[model samples]
Target: MKVDALYREQEQLAKKAVFYDAFGKLDSIAGIDCSYYGDLIIGGAVVIDLNTLEPVEKAHTILKLDFPYIPGLLAYREAKAMISACRKLKSDVDVLMIDGFGTNHPRRCGIATQIGLQLEMPTIGVGKSFLCGNIRDDGYVYQGAERTGKLIYSSRSKKPVYVSPGHRISLDTSVELVEKCMKSDRIPEPTRLAHEYVTGVKNTLK
Candidate 1:
């Protein structure tokens, strides 16, 4: 499909996103991330027990890149491998935290939103860099006049990670959960481990 068409699709799907709280107590959380190797995509998922903040289960998947990496339409390129790896997990997690943007995008439909909607699960997005918003003194990220998400400085980092609701989740809860998952790393444990796993797989191939 053309770029314009894909943009339109993102806008349409974003309307289905839910901003209210839709979950009970979160016992476990999973984080997913993808690494690239030429035309291949290596995706990894790590599920951690929320109480101890230790990994309970992990899985990885390697797949071909079907879509080009566009600026805003990242889900088209990476969501496939991410979802595949996530589905490989035997333990069911209460939430899925993905290493990407959620509603904090131009169209409000990011890779995390796409993946959450596809999996019918609650998901949060963690953007390492500022995507498309102005961070206020209160740390709320704003796209134009609408509040999209929040900027949180994790315990071990000078930089802040943007946290946003992907689907079937609220922004406040997204931040709360992400902060709980952070260990001695700037990124949350789930996603941090997932990234490390995928990077290890990529290194092995080289």
Candidate 2:
């Protein structure tokens, strides 16, 4: 995949603020996660009803690996399988919460952003570790009081994992959603469940 083209496509989606308004009366959200099998990628997309916090549907798939694991080109390697799994959903998702970055990338495009743009849906990126952003520790309390005026630096490489919009959301909303989805830990519940499902499926296959 041409990096420049992909970047341009996502940038356009980000610029079109109208797309962000599509998220109307969202009742459910889905979380997607993948596990690599040496040469293959097996993944699962789990949809949970926000009101009840129960699993509504799940889609899983295994795809042969084709792209190399480039530092920033992860979407190319995993987008096909992720999209395939998402297509298996029988119900429409109000929002998609992915276990990766969104606009918090070198090209302002990440797996979450790419997938959201392709599907034209609202998506959130919640990374497990730092990818490319900075987190200030200016007496900010963790796992409690919400941090105020915390800005993610997309222009800095050494920055921390940024919480930004993907297709149909705002940066502030994304960060708040992430915080709301957290279940007594740093990782959110949707992504944590996805990680467990993906890893469990991979282990069973092995």
Candidate 3:
């Protein structure tokens, strides 16, 4: 999909959609993470059983980061690596949890959205920090209370990360799944584990 077409597609989907509804069936989930070599990208994906939370399969791939770190066009830089890794997975995933924002992006089509849309699978975005949208300290859980259609300003830098719905999931569901996946630390278990594995491999190659 072209970069400019993202917003148009989102607008069309938004008009006819119910933002949140019980999906009713989800047994397996996959997580994706990427590491960069000075700008070159390497991706890792792991599929885990939702009931046992045990890893069933994993895959990794490396791809050149051809695009610059553009604010709204991040999928162009990372999607190829993610897709490559995901294609290698031996098991099918009912849902995907990505280390990014979902429905929390400027374009409303972040990397997680891109992947989910392309693969026609459910996906969620969970970033360590705010991407877009205002996070309310008021303890409200819903998107309206937290904020929407706003950029998530980072403390370290003014440039914000993008978040948005990936596919077959609601923003509220994304948030809930993220909380469930958390294992004490801020990062979720699948993403955290993938990070550890990929970083370990990168370190060994050094």
User: Is candidate 1 or 2 superior in TM-score?
Assistant: 1
| Candidate 2 C-alpha lDDT tens digits along 153-203 | 233233333455666776667776666665554566677677888898899
Best candidate (score: lDDT): 1
lDDT of 1 at 32: 97
- Writing each residue's lDDT as its tens digit, candidate 1 over 6-86 gives 999999999998887788888999989999999999999999999998888989999988898789999999999999998
Give me the displacement of residue 4 in model 2, in angstroms: 6.9
Return the lDDT, model 2, position 41: 97
Model 3 lDDT per residue over 33-62, tens place? 888876568889988888777788888987
What is the model-wide C-alpha lDDT for candidate 1? 0.92
Provide the RMSD of all predictions against the true structure, rounded to 1 decimal: 0.9, 6.5, 5.2
**Inter-residue clash pairs, candidate 3:** 102-164, 103-163, 103-164, 103-165, 104-163, 104-164, 105-163, 113-166, 132-152
Candidate 1, residue 41: how far the Cα is off, in Å: 0.2
Q: What is the lDDT of candidate 2?
A: 0.70
Alpha carbon RMSD to native, model 2: 6.5
Candidate 3 runs further than 4 Å off? 1-24, 137-164
